[model samples]
Target: MNILFIEDDRMNRRVVRDMLDVAGATMTEAESAEEGLQLIDTQDFDMILVDLRMPGMDGITAIGHIRAREDEKAKLPIIVVTADAAVDLRDRCIEAGADDVIFKPVAMDALFDAMGRLLARDSDGMLY
Candidate 1:
């Protein structure tokens, strides 16, 4: 699967990249929300993992920009990979169009589980 990970921290990106490598998936890294958005415009991805905090734009706003797109790409699965522990973080992400939310210092299994769930569903929201 092709995945785009938008995170500012180089170490976090490295860790996730290693995890994706182990899963035999290809990952494209973006250091900021702006870069991630530009990547989205140019390439397609099976899934996106975004960090909540970034220099230019936050992950939630980025998801909103994606969901507002005038094409099928708007439906691309997105997972919020954040360190935020706010009481309403998950709710906020869902409201902003995230398919799932995974916490920072992510576990390999959790990442795979979330990806699997999203991949198993068709665009119509039915199991494939």
Candidate 2:
């Protein structure tokens, strides 16, 4: 699968990239939300993992922009990969269009499981 990870921290991106590599998934790195949005216009990805906080645009705002797209890309599955543990974080992410929320430091199994579940959705957008 092709995954786009939008994170400002270099180490965080590298760690996720290595994990994705093990799953035979190609992860395209984006250092910021703006860069990720631009990439979305030029490429296709099976999933998107966005950091909650970044320089300039936040992950929630990015997801909103993606969901606001005029094309089919608006339905792209998104996951919020955040370190924050705000009680309402998950709700906020879902409200902003994320399919799921996974906290950091992320475990490989957790990441794989979230991806598998979201990608396994049926045509009606229900979990299968």
Candidate 3:
């Protein structure tokens, strides 16, 4: 599957990249929300993995913008990968249009499970 991963931290990005690579999934990395948005405008992805915190245009705002787009790709599954596991933070992400949230450091199995579930729901037309 093609996935877009937006993260500001190089180390975290590398870790996720390696994991995805080993899973045989293709991924495109974005260093910031702006870059991620630009990529969204031009490419097609099965899902999006976004970091909650960034220097500018945080993931929540990015999710809002993404959901606001008129294209069908705007409805693509969005999973927040964040270090913050607080209840309010999770609520905010869901309210912002994220399909699911996974905390860091991300476990490979959980990441794959979340991706699989979201992709399955999306194919079954059960995702909103």
Candidate 4:
């Protein structure tokens, strides 16, 4: 699977990349939301994993930008990965067009579980 990972923190970026690699995702990472958006415009991904906080555009805004695009690209499954675990934060992410949300420091099991659900739903054409 292809994953677009947007994160600015170097250590967190390395950790998440390693975990996703171990999980069999071919990852394309960007240090900020602007870079990530540029990548999304030029390439395709099975899933988009974004950090809520960043130096430039935030994840919520980034997801909105992606969703505002055309066709299948606009409908891409976007998963917000963040340390902000508050229910209100999650609701805001979902409201901003994130297909799902995962909290950071990302638990491998939970992250993979969320990915499984999203991929399954995408493939089956049914909500997971």
- lDDT, residue 73, model 2: 89
Q: Give the Å shift of residue 124 in candidate 1.
A: 1.3
Tell me how far the alpha carbon of residue 119 in candidate 3 is from the true structure, in angstroms, after superposition: 0.9
lDDT tens readout by residue for model 1, 1-128: 89999999999999999999998999999999999999999998989999999987999999999999998889999999998999999999999999999998899999999999999998797878
Task: For residues 1-128, write the lDDT of model 4, one tens digit per residue.
Answer: 88999998888878878898898789888999999999998998988989999987998899999999886788788889899868699789989999788887888898888888888884445965
Q: Write the per-residue lDDT of candidate 2 for residues 6-109, one digit (tens) a residue.
A: 99999999999999999899999999999999999999998999998998999999999999999988998999999999999899999999999998998999
Q: Candidate 3: which stretches are off by over 4 Å? A: 122-128
Model 1: colliding residue pairs: none
Those runs of model 4 whose alpha carbons end farther than 4 Å from true positions after fitting are 123-125
Question: Which run of 10 residues does model 3 get worst, by summed lDDT?
Answer: 119-128
For all candidates, the clash counts are: 0, 0, 0, 0
Candidate 3 lDDT (Cα, whole model)?
0.93
Provide the global lDDT of candidate 4 against the true structure: 0.87
Question: Per-residue lDDT of 1-128 in model 3, one digit per residue for the tens?
Answer: 89999999999999999999998999899999999999999999989999989998999999999999998988899999999868698889989999999999999998999998887774555855
lDDT score, residue 19, model 4? Answer: 90
lDDT of 1: 0.94
Instruction: Give the Å error, residue 106, model 4.
Output: 0.8
By TM-score rank, best first, the candidates go 2, 1, 3, 4
Better of 2 and 4 by lDDT: 2
In model 2, state the lDDT of residue 1: 85
Task: Kindly report which residue pairs in candidate 2 clash with one another.
Answer: none
